[model samples]
Target: MVTLDWTATEIALSLGISPVGCAEISGYKTWVNVANEGLADAVDVGRRQQPSLEAIRKLQPDLILTSRYRHASIARALGEIAPVHLIDDQENEDDMLASVYQSAHQAGAALSRSDDVARLLESFDGEIEKLRTGHAGQVEGRKLVVAQPLPGVPRLRAFAPNAAISGLLRKIGFADGSQMSAQPFGFATVDLEGLASLENDSTLFILGEAIPDDLLHASLWPMLPIVAQGNVRLTGIPSWPFGSTASLKHLARQIVTRFV
Candidate 1:
């Protein structure tokens, strides 16, 4: 298996598959909680933008798979060493589901629990429908404003229009109050004052690892209306913020059930 992002790597491990090797953006470990599996022995080939070709050549993985949207060149470079598959991420519900199923098709038998995958998907669909009906009377069809605490970086990072959270929101029929739309995987910076000025209620799905104190009690956060009013839903997910198509469905369900 081949992966270019933390989410894909996490998915591979969840599927009971391991890459002969892989790469990601620098400091991946800084944000993602490394799973206890092949990742223990897996080599960090290089950063997403610049993977070490020499290292990948040494690993000589049988097949490489990458999200088509994130690292095209890395996928191409990996292809020289082995067969590379670029998994596409789509916006619409149908296209997104196709992207996921297509990913399962690519995984072949590496997925240890095909039954689990199917069950998770079904569960997500069922919960989504239930939530849609369950909350109709109280939610007033609110939209979600997904945000994440920017540690050390002096600004707030909000999900762009097409990031993972945004995609999931649209999937579950939440109104898209998307102010940022140029990217499928992107973050835009905001100051505390700026965050207060933005007035889209809906739900706020905050992403990132579980650093509660930095996020919850930080001086900048307490003043925000979203935080003060309990409108923000903080989700303790990894830095890459995405995973296998099936794994993503799990994340999607958790987001909707918790925030929607």
Candidate 2:
């Protein structure tokens, strides 16, 4: 099997299937940051947008998995090399968790790992339940905003209610506090002033390896209620907000241990 989508790559790795080839391999390692060992021996097919057709043709995989959003234009081209399965990358529903489950199942079915996928999802549900029960007293219904401050910039990308990360947080009893409307890609770019509109009681979770000093010293920073009240949390852990069930489980554990 070969995968051109990072989410599909994650699902394949979680199911113990090492793909023969993948696109943007290093990007997946740096962003997704899960089950990377499975990709150790996999060949890099090339960029996600314009994969090296020659390289993929050489691999001659039995199955090829890619995102409908990214590969729809090249579906026919990819099909010539192997059976192509397009994975829906959009979270086009009210329930992002359900979207994750459905994507996992679709990938599992394509890989003939239906039973493994079922167990993976069941375990994910169990983990979520444990966290919900354990943290309900403190986190239940508490509004939270998740965002990543762009390095060296005043703007940050805030996750909307429909984002996978926000949905996972919801499962653990936190309510989305982002003031922005639901976006198709699950986040919106906003400046400090935009974030200041959030409710005072909302907890702000910042996702980044390191907070920029400029942001901390920005004139508007100290004035933000969430910052003034010490309700801001800096997640120094590197994370990929958009990922599969395995990545979500990994993030859930980190959230419970470090942020909760």
Candidate 3:
């Protein structure tokens, strides 16, 4: 099997299936960094948007998995090479966590690994429940703004209520405090002034790389109530906020250990 979607690659790896080929292997390693060992033997097909059809054909895969969002235009072309399975990237707009599970189930069915997927999801549920019960008293009901500082820019990409990370945080009892509304892609890019509407007591959970020095030392940085109260936290770990079940599990452990 070959996977052109990073999320599909993750789901395949979680099910103990190593794809014969994957797109953007290096980007996947840097961004969606979970289950990497599964990719060790896979051939790089090319970029997610424009995968090398010749390279994929060389793999002679029986099945090809890709995102509807990214590969809808090339679905027919991919089908010519092999049976193509389109995984909806936007399966459930209102509940991104549910979307992740749905995507996993879809991949499992295609790969005939439904049993493994079921076990994986069951374990994920138990782990989430344990974290929820254990940290409810300490973190429940706290408002959180999850944001990623754009590299070399002063803007932030804040996850909205419908984002996967926000939904996972909600399961662990924290409320989404981002002022942005539900967006199809899950986040909104905003300038620092846009964050002024957030509640004073809300915690700012900055994802990915550290905030650049320029932004941290901006004149308006310390004026925010959350900054003044020292409620800001850098994850200090690479995170793919839009990843699958394993990625969510990884992120949940990171949040609890680093901030709880």
Number of the top-ranking candidate, with lDDT as the measure: 3
Summarize candidate 2's per-residue lDDT along 111-140 as a digit string, tens digits.
Answer: 888999999999989988999998788788
Query: In TM-score terms, which candidate is top?
Result: 3
lDDT (C-alpha, whole model) for all candidates: 0.59, 0.84, 0.85
TM-score of each: 0.66, 0.94, 0.96
What TM-score does model 1 achieve against the real structure? Answer: 0.66
After superposition, which runs of candidate 1 have C-alpha atoms over 4 Å from their true positions?
24-38, 74-77, 90-140, 170-187, 208-224, 227-230, 236-240, 246-260
Between prediction 2 and prediction 3, the one with superior TM-score is 3
Clashing pairs in 3: none
> lDDT at 98 for candidate 1?
49
What is the C-alpha local distance difference test score of candidate 2?
0.84
Q: What stretches of model 3 exceed 4 Å from their correct place? A: none
lDDT of 3: 0.85
Candidate 1 accuracy as lDDT = 0.59
